[model samples]
Target: MNPRNNRQVRLRSRPNGIPQAEHFEIAQVPVEPLAPGQVLVRNEWLSVEPAMRGWVNAVANYSEPVAIGAVMRAFAAGRIVESTMPEWPVGTAVTGMFGWQDFAAIEPAAIQRRIVDEDLPISTALGVLGINGITAHYGLLEVGHPRAGETVVVSTAAGAVGSCVGQIAKLRGCRTVGITGGETKRRMCIDRFGYDAAVDYKAPDFEQRLAEALPGGVDVYFDNTAGAISDAVLARLNVGARVVICGTASVANWDPPPLGPRVERHLLTRRARMQGFVIFDHPEHTPIALEDLAGWVRAGRLHYVEEVLEGIDSAPDAIAGLYRGENLGKRLIRLA
Candidate 1:
């Protein structure tokens, strides 16, 4: 049964630096009837990622900035409960940019992915089997291109995308070193995610530890946080190293752009290639990504973590929590 009111987390104001809990408010509005080629989806899980910081900020990203008074744009997984569209009939499980809402009356074109692996957990569609997996697959393999027996260091290594990148690097027979914030995640990198070694960036001896972790120097750097940690990694890049720019989590402001170590010298001396990865730009790799990621999940070759918070009200504070490094892995709000 379709709900009458749609509860959506609406952007009340654009933030100066990072999105805060106060910037959003949940409002329940009457669900509109489905128009032709439109489907009503009951969003079961809402995702909070590092990238949402850019979406709500007053800056141009790959996508347009989230306008004030609009539903806070986000990725969510749900089921089609009602449809005027044949492609997405009632009860079809799907994932899309459905925003932070309980229900959505969206056109079929809005659906980013059609959930094919119904046997797996529905939440995977938003994470490992979704953008996270796709981004890691292409960014590392296509962009970073780690060869077997190379040293691959990943920042934010225990995060959703970073975790996947670490595992995939290992699967390619590469030596993996994970750089994360806390001691807990550092241990998780070694024990849970199968990293050869992990360094805690918050530690006082972080540079020493990172150096020890990479005695032979870095062949591939999977960068998620582009700040001080990246500078350290950049300083130690091996000749012909590849740097994949995935996310800039630690960057507070990019309007005038925060100044840091110049990357040109590093790139020139190491003869390395650094390229930014926006997952939407690599749609051709989706099928292989979904296939291999799903197969790995079933075979226990890949593992994922999800920290689920309950209900729509949890959505507002979730993005801010992500910036604070509160969640262990992919953070999703589960609707009851």
Candidate 2:
């Protein structure tokens, strides 16, 4: 393959707040010849996630920040077009951390999962059947275990992970409440995602609405945005409630961490358990989660929406759009 044919989005600078187009630079490079045991894949879909904000920031977090001038880190799904490895034959669909590039020449070890289930669109490998679904499954079921008739509140309720979490919690017989921004997304949380109640966090009476939504107090809080929204949810936690810190979408920067109401009092008063969830920690459960999620999707029990941006140039703006709440469900970039 010609080097000029390979296009990549590189991290030009560390973001101070939410990332902008100026933080990234697109470059055309020559594709390197495959090393022994390496496969060359042409990406079909690239996932744009809220966690990306942390990935590009200068501050340290669960994972190392993407170094300056490196290809932007991302989870992508594609088909192997050329291979020196016998195991990864040409045309095998795969999902992996291939960064923001059109083609990736990587060892088999870099591939996270081979995309089977030809019955579904290959892009589902980056959405419902991928990290988003897996994160929702383990985070809610294993961590925020909800019981029948219990109230389960999820922040960022209309997003990729939160939407799945709400639906899964409902399947478990729990009453679900979703907190999102704007009326459109709030309505989507109830009408599309099947949440029992939805509250607009941007409303003037958000606290009141949240209280009304969960009159019984929150039994399980799937905390995705750890800002003022979390503060309200923490205050409403019932005794022994479980709080799963999945993602921090609301907080702009974490380096000089934003100050907020102390959570010690809330946790102590409610005797609640707040745990952080990292999907990579439980790799063994991925297959189990995918099995159940795929089944639900086939049965029409699970519903998902995707906002797709065509071509690699759209990636930088897509990231900014996500922070602006411009997407309704899963946000993806279609490369092919």
Candidate 3:
């Protein structure tokens, strides 16, 4: 039987910088009965993403700010326990913006995509087969347009999306370089993710090391963190280079968008092309991306890791931890 109440992590206030556990409050409200066209989903895994930082902030980003005092918006994987709609039968697994709650009473439209690969773990729907994987695929191939024998550089290289990007770039016959935080993640980028070279941005000689790693210059750059690190990579771009801006993780505040990047002069000099990519803008192509990601996983060519924090209580500090590079892989909150 379902629990009597739904325990949730609700947003209490917006943060000026990285959101902390103190910004949220955990509360239990009685679960409402399922209404017409609604399904009761017992959310099992809550995805923790860097993009979530934009969600809670006062910034006007790709999506509207998650309202104050509302349930924290999140992508979660779960099973449908009770459904009023025949199309979504009970026992069906689903994933979508199910919020940071254990039980969700939501309409059919609330389900973004159903969990389809029975062989893969359900948690993957919120990780490898979910946002991170899809983002990596589209951002690299479609936007960056990496070619064989070219050098492809990725920022946040050992993290979920960057890791996937490095591996995919390698499979496409490109020489891959990873730019990450520390020695530990640097090693993981090379030893685990199959990058040709990995550079630690936190190192005192970061620029020198990064230049050494890219002797041929960057042909395609998949940038996840846009700050000083990106500025260094921009200077080393080969002619006709392509840069795909996937996220701006290093910037904490976007009250006014950062402008006049030093990279523009480099772009003009090298005849390079740079563009921003947000997956939500291409909903028509999401299914195709998912199908390819699943195929890669099943064939053993693609590898992904999960850094799962036990229990709903972990949701509060999760976004802050993500920005800190505390997670080595895709982070998730396991609700049991």
Candidate 4:
């Protein structure tokens, strides 16, 4: 591999609110020859997730954020261009936390999962069959256990995690409703992902519409967005309901952490359980979730969409777009 062939998106500055292009710097990095047990990968797809927001910030969440001047952290899919590792042959595909780069010199241990099923698009490994799928599966089943006929409402309803949550809930025979930004997303949620219904938060009477949509009262709330949308859903929780506090996409950019209506009253009134969990806590449960998720995909019960942007230079903007609700589904950057 030529040293000058590598390209990466580096963090130029810490973001104040939503990140802009000035915050990122695309540089053509030099890749050294691989070590005895290393591999050089040609990245094909990079997953743009809300979690990337926390990664770029200095915030100490479940993991440490990317430091200034470092390559912006991201999960990507790539093909092995050169390898000394026996397990990973050249031209083999893989998914891992390879960051915002077109070419990566990584050890075999750094490869999270090898792409084996040739029929499925390699991009799916970064989304429906990747971290997003695991997040939705574990967050819902491990946290928001949906019983048959229970209502499950997901925030960020048409996104990667939210879409997987809805499809999985529907597969479990639960009545599923999605809360998304626009009518188009809402329609996509129902028509494409098998969500029983969807509520458009951009509508004038969103709260009333949400109420009308889930009349049975939400039994399992997959709380992805944690501001007003969460407040509305919390208020409608049934007794003994379970709430999975996933990402707070709705409030990711709030500096003062925009005032949220107290939902403790609803918790007490309904005696519902609201638990916040980072999916990594249950690493052993990933395969359990993936097994079922893959089966669902094979059974035609799961549908996925990806909004792919090309090049590593586009990664920063692609990530920022997730916060702005510009992405229709799982936002990814295609490098190859």
Candidate 5:
């Protein structure tokens, strides 16, 4: 097979608050031929997740930050173009840690999943059926442990993981409450995702509104935004409540006068437990979670949204968008 040229997005600088276009640099790269046990893949859709911010900063305990001059790390969906490995046939659809590049050279084993059918959009594998959905599933089920007839709350309620958390809670017969940034997102949480209720954090009386929505107290708090909203959720935690520490979108930008209040008192008063999870550590449960999520989507019990940008050139801005909350659902950059 002929070698192809690819484009890749690299981290140019680290941002202090919200990342800017200047932080990313785009460059053309030459794709190498697939060696034995390796495959050459062309990325179709690239996921820009909130965890990417943690990757950029080099801080998450489990994963280090993206070093300057390196191709930005990201999970992506793509089709194999050439493969010397029997396990991954050419033209096979797959998803994994493909990073922010138009084309990549990856070992067959590193390819997490092979597509069963092309009927489902490839992007779903990256968001709902991929890491995002798995994270929501395990985090909520194992950590949050939502019980029927109890109230379940999630922050960043309109984003990918938060959206899935709310829907799953609803399916389990829990009263689901979503905390989102604006009216549009609030409406989406209730109308689109079928949350029992939603609160707009941008509203003047958000705290009171959230309280009114969850009168029985929150049984499961699947926290995606760790700031005041989490504190507010903590205050409403039911006795023996379980809090899932998923993502901290609230403090992505390390600025003076940190946002949100201390929540230790709330945790103590409610006699609740809060736990943080890294999805990678639980690879054994991935297939089960993906099968469950895929079933939900097929049955129309779950819905997903994706903000897809075309080309690797837009990857930098796409990564920056997650911090500013510019895009909805799963933010991705599509490459041909």
Candidate 6:
């Protein structure tokens, strides 16, 4: 690899189920000169999210899948090293869809948000203050609409977005329940994330435990892992319950459309409202969500955790690790 080169993790092939390291190729390519109105960034941190699995899949989705031989798309935070735009001068800290690369030359329009809170860690721009936080804010408050004294349940409760959803729901005076994969995450959900109750989905008595936790029934169910865990949650929905469909982590693949217990009966019997939300569709809510999230952070009311991996090579395996429940919180890769 040349010293003056950009190292990037590109999509070598589409995966059948969960993506493997073989599906990605890390290559060193020459850094191109910045064009007019473009900024060159040295990415310090790259986000590894569950959504990346969908992005690499050949199946149709809300967004276009990453083409083979293209750089794997990702949200990254970095410092501007060179710039042709006055607004994005050298040393500006910014976050955007910069992909899994050590260096990126991006147009100003591609920049999503600038990291202005110097007091906070720059990585927070990719974690709590970034898409994860924003997604939780809108999905819970706007979509789920939990009222005081209501019971709110979140799947993947120890993960990035799910953790934030539980905390925010608690602030609204809702009884928050978290469903995670293992004992450690379950404990983290209750002890660290401040969920009223935490249940392990991997446990043999998961359904019984969930029933015991939500005695009053679930008023708001934030669905992150939509499979058997969701099936159990749907069965516990209160009349007029709100189901926020977020991520589908439990299902291994979407190509063949994995069959599960039908939800129409649950919705009809409970008079529930189920809606799917893609954060990208609601750009108008970003500023307000960020403002509220930042305020909560400053007041020490909101808490977050980040599990960072070192080097660009860690990007491929990092995604696999996320699905395997290896990451306790927000999984990130430090490229610099």
Could you tally the backbone clashes for each prediction?
A: 0, 3, 0, 0, 1, 0
Better of 2 and 4 by lDDT: 2
lDDT, candidate 2, 116-204, per-residue tens: 99899988888889999999999999999889989999999999999999999999999999999999999999899999999999999
Clashing residue pairs in candidate 1, if any?
none
lDDT of 6 by residue, 14-94 (tens): 997788889999988999988888899999999998889889888858889999999999999999999988878899999
Better of 3 and 5 by lDDT: 3
Error of 5 at 76 (Å): 1.0
Question: Which RMSD does model 5 reach against the true structure?
Answer: 2.1
Pick the lDDT winner: 6
lDDT per residue as tens, model 4, 78-174: 8998989787899899888888888888888788878876678889898999899999998998889899999999999899999999988988889
Cα lDDT of model 6 overall?
0.93
TM-score of 3: 0.97
Which regions of candidate 3 are displaced past 4 Å? Answer: 256-261
Angstrom error at residue 327, model 1: 0.7
Q: Give, for candidate 6, the lowest lDDT window spanning 10 residues.
A: 1-10
> Which portions of model 4 miss their true places by more than 4 Å?
1-4
Model 1 weakest 10-residue run by lDDT: 1-10
Candidate 6 local lDDT, residue 305: 97
Q: With candidate 3 superimposed using the best TM-score fit, by how many Å does residue 172's alpha carbon deviate from the native?
A: 0.7
The TM-scores, one per candidate, come to 0.98, 0.97, 0.97, 0.96, 0.94, 0.98
Model 1, residue 161: what's the lDDT?
95
Please, what are the lDDT tens digits per residue for candidate 1 over residues 227-256?
Answer: 999999999999999999999999888878
On TM-score, the stronger of 2 and 5 is 2
- Model 4 compared with the native: what TM-score? 0.96
What is the model-wide C-alpha lDDT for candidate 4? 0.86
lDDT of 5 by residue, 193-241 (tens): 9988999988999889988898888888888877777777887878788
| Model 5 TM-score, all chains together | 0.94
